[model samples]
Target: MTQRRTPSGQGPARRPGRTSRPTQRVRVRDTSSTRVEPRVARQARPVAAKRTAAQKGATKRTVAPRPRAITGRATVVIAVLVALVLAYTYPLRVYLAQESQIAKMKQAQDIQRRLIAEKADEVALWSDEEYVVAQARERFYYVRPGETPLIVLNDPAGAARDAGHAPAAPAADRWYDTLWSSVQAADSEPRN
Candidate 1:
């Protein structure tokens, strides 16, 4: 241990090989020159001064507590989000509707394509000589090379039900009579 003398003629002991720790400097505020704002002075002022000081300080905005302003901002954000969702949804709804319509049209087109394919098959069948002759003989009772043809009769009950529309006859009747009757019906004027 070594003894160190201060400038004021006082002695303090210093330890050997251990440097002294630096002293922390603290700044003291000089409130003498500072202005006491009306807001800060309001709390410490007398009741008589409180009214006057509060009136004066009311115009200066203090640090605001956050919730009200935060809630207001949240409301605006929610409204904007809702508006944006609606704006996007309108187009999305229309897009979905159009997509559904396109799907329906495509389905209808597929059905029509199938019908066209069936009609094409019929045309191919009609182009064949055997198929044409067979259809003609079945539908119109056509005979080939002096072949004897037989006619099958429809039920008498069905023939009676259709009697009012045209003269109902058995399918066993002569083909020439049925053909002549159909020609006469076609040449007649349209009924009211």
Candidate 2:
């Protein structure tokens, strides 16, 4: 163990610090006394590395954030979509109702056409005077020009056919077997 003592007696350590080794001091030339020592101190720990209020103030400036924008396109699109749906739905409902009504009107038109055809046939039949007279005689037992009226009971078919086709007994037929049927029918007969 040798002692390193500078001519000024100052060395690498200014004060004694604890070490795990026995004090085996070595003798070596100390370079700290040279004029280059200040640069050496600056190399070990820079002045900029230290924390200070003036140094913190030199940091880059930041701007406060502007308010975030609220996009309204999506809201407008949804509103338009709802309006379009209503527009389409209203017409669709009206079209369905109109379609059903058109079907009912067509059915009524077909019934009217059938009735017109039947009425045209009856009008043609009524144009014949013989048809008018025959119809009046059959329904009303009508006589014309003081003609004597006779009921002929001959059967081009049979007597059973005549009796079968004769005017149906009135509603009284069911009341008293045959008695009320005769009376009611006689009472309702056209006066000769």
Top of the candidates by lDDT: 1
- Per-residue C-alpha lDDT of model 2 across residues 1-192, encoded as one tens digit per residue: 333545444432432453443465866666688543333342533532563334543433345556556458877888999999988998999999999999999999999999999999999999999999999999898999889989886654476566676554446445476887798899999997
Clashes of each: 0, 1
What C-alpha lDDT, on a 0 to 100 scale, does residue 39 get in candidate 1?
43
Tens digits of per-residue lDDT for model 1, 1-192: 435655445434554565766577977788799975664443543753766476643333335345565577799999999999989998999999999999999999999999999999999989999998999998888998879988879776767677755554646858898899999998896977
TM-score of 2: 0.34
Reference-based TM-score of each model = 0.44, 0.34
Between which residue pairs do clashes occur in model 2? 2-25
Residue 132 of model 1, lDDT score: 86
Worst 10 residues of 1 by lDDT: 56-65
RMSD of each: 23.0, 26.8
